[model samples]
Structures are given as structure tokens and as C-alpha cells.
Target: MATAKQPVTAPTVISVDDFLAGNPDERRRADAGRLRAIMGELTGEPAVMWGPSIVGFGSYHYTYESGRSGDAPLVGFSPRKQNLVLYLTGGGLEERDDALLARLGPHRAGQGCIYLRRLDDVDESVLRQLIERTVQVHRGVDGGSGR
Candidate 1:
């Protein structure tokens, strides 16, 4: 199972520029740039900085059973200090049967997240499929719509 490396505690909020600025390593900056490209290609939407750290694409609103409702990005990603957090608001991998997800490098799938230590560790094809599927989900192209 893939797990996130140690994350910066308190999760320092970061603007896009600040995030890039903090990465002294050119590789990190390149990784982020690659991710942005993939997100745009997969989602067919322009990426938006949802908050300080999260780069999101698309949008939707949801209401919980508790009557709590909020707006969230349809698909998004975050470059945490320790790892990359792929926000799959659409859903998560089920078991190890899914071809696309299985191809993704070792990863731990939660209901709404896919954690990765590095971009090089993941299979580009699989990652692209996941992102494409997720974008469709967010757009209600599949049976289930956004929550």
C-alpha cells in the first residue's frame, strides 16, 4: 500500500506562488508543472486555485444528511510537503481489480483521495485514466453525479 510521507504539521496554507517559491528544487517545480498539465488535459477544464494549496478544476455543491452543505472542487490536487494528494471527489478505487487504478503505482485509496509520494512512482497512463474518469463523474456523465 502506498502511503503519504510525513506531512508538514498544521498544513501551512500556501498560495500558488508561495508553494512554488518554497520549492527550491527545480524538480519539485517541474513535478508541479507536469501535474498541472495532466489536470488540465484530463479535466478539459482550467485549473483553479481553490485555496492556498489546492489546485482544483470544476466545481459542485453538496448537502450532507446532517443538513450541512458546501461547495467543493470536482477534481483537484494538492502538493503537500511530504507527498501529492490527488483529490478524487468522484470516488475511489475498489479492490485491486480496476485495470486503470491497478496500474497506478502503489497507492492507498480513500473515498475521496489518492496519495502518492512522487509523480515518477506512478504510472502516467493509469493516472490519466483516473483523472479522466473523475472529470466525467464530476460532470455527471456517468450514472452518479457530484455529491
Candidate 2:
């Protein structure tokens, strides 16, 4: 008999309000709240507490070459002590991404994520476009299989 595999992360019952109040201070809560609203609208998915910290919207199943697979949020954000992190796959669309980031103001990009110290530092409209593109590409709206 084989045992069932367990996922490392899954949605939790924690509400966005509680999570924000519990985790970050009042200052960070404002920022996280802003992201939650933005992501919720853009993904057209209700907010759910992912794992313990990440407030996620939408979900997609991912399979690796090694056969490992799991579901992850389509787009999410987490407020950290150092920086608020934006979870984005980028959908391998670099040319468009490069152009957007250039005008996105100051930020740091990492694998499938963007870190920002403050939301006020970036252009709101540009950020919206970037997120919209990421969702589109990941959802196959860009004419490829869902990433």
C-alpha cells in the first residue's frame, strides 16, 4: 500500500483581516490590504489564506519533469519585515516584462517574485499592467498552455 502524499502548502481558514492584523503591524497592514484588493480584482478570484502567511487569489496546478505536482496561487502577495513580496510567474514573457519593469520604478525581481519596500515607490498603473500580463500568460490567454 502507498501512503498519500501531503502538500507543503494549502489554503488556511485564516481571514485576510485576521492575518493582516496578526502578522504585520498597522503600517504594513495598510499595504497588504491594498495588494489583497488589487490581486483579488485582477485575478477575479476570492481571497484565501494560503499556508500561514500568503494571501492568495486563484490557483493552478503545476507538474514538474520529475512528476512532482502541486497547486499554487495564480498571483499573491506577502508582507515581510524587509519588503512586501509579489508572487508572479512572469509566464516566460520577457520582452514585455523588461519594458514594464523599466518603467515600474524601483524594485527587485527574483524568481517568480518581485520585492518592494513600499507600494508608493512604484507606479500603480504599471504594476497593474504587469500583474494583468502575468495572469493572462499563466492562464493561457497568451495562446500557450497554462503555465
Candidate 3:
């Protein structure tokens, strides 16, 4: 008999209030609030906690070429000690995204993540554009299959 395949998605536990309240530092807490509002507005979805730290807005199912599959947020963020990490789904930023990031001010960009030391460190409008584009890209990728 074949063994049942295990799900790869992390349990969506932890409430947004609890997570924000749990932050000991006021600055980080405030930053989390800013991120939550931005992501919520961009995705037009309520924020949901993914795992223990990440606050995710929307979700999508993804399958790798190797057949490994999992569900993940279309956009999300985590307020960490060093920085606020923004997670953008559907892969890295495109050319237009790079232009927006250029105007976004002080920050770091990774494969699909954008890191900001504080909300004031960047242009909020540009950040919103980036998130909006990310949501559009991912939604188009899977036909808005997110929950």
C-alpha cells in the first residue's frame, strides 16, 4: 500500500491581535500595524497568521516541477528584530517592480521578499504599488485561486 502524502502548508493559527500584542517593543508593534493595513488594503483580504510569526493576506496553492506542493500567502509580512520582512508570492519582482522599489527608498530585496527597517524608512505609496502588483501577478498565475 502507498503511504498518504503529507500536506506542506503550515497551520494557519495565531490571531492578528495576539501576534501584534505579543510584540514587546512598541516600535515593532506599530510597524506590524502599518504592514497589516497595507497588505489588507492591497489584497482586499483580511490578514491571517501563518505559522507563529507571519501575518498573511491571501493564499495560493503552488506545485513545484519536482511535484512538491504547498499553499502560501499571496502577500505577507513579519515584524522581526532586525527588519520588517515582506513576502511577495509568484516569484521575484519584475522590471516595473524594480522601478517601484527604486523609488521605495531604503530597503533590501530578496527573491520574493522586501525588507524594511521601519515604515518611515520607505515611501508608503510605492510600497502599496509593489504589493498591488504582487497580488495581481500571483492572482493571474493561478486564476485567483487563493482562499
Q: Which one is best on lDDT?
A: 2
Task: Choose 1 or 3, whichever is better by lDDT.
Answer: 3
lDDT tens string, model 1, 50-131?
A: 7667877767666766776666777788777677788875333454226767778887777768888788989898888787
lDDT of 2: 0.81
Which is the leading candidate under TM-score? Answer: 2
Q: Name the 10 consecutive residues with the lowest summed lDDT in model 1.
A: 5-14
Question: Which should have the higher TM-score, number 1 or number 2?
Answer: 2
Clashes of 3: 0
Put the candidates in lDDT order, highest first. 2, 3, 1
Q: Please list the C-alpha lDDT of all candidates, in the order they appear.
A: 0.70, 0.81, 0.80
Estimate candidate 1's alpha-carbon lDDT, on a 0 to 1 scale. Answer: 0.70
Off by over 4 Å in 1: 1-18, 90-98
Residue-pair clash count for candidate 1? 0
RMSD of each: 8.0, 2.1, 3.2
Clashes of each: 0, 0, 0
- Winner on lDDT between 1 and 2 is 2
lDDT of 1 at 143: 50
lDDT of 2 by residue, 1-147 (tens): 999877756788888788788764666788888988899899999988888888888888877767877888888889988889998874454444788888988998866688888898999999998888778866768764344
- Candidate order by TM-score, decreasing, is 2, 3, 1
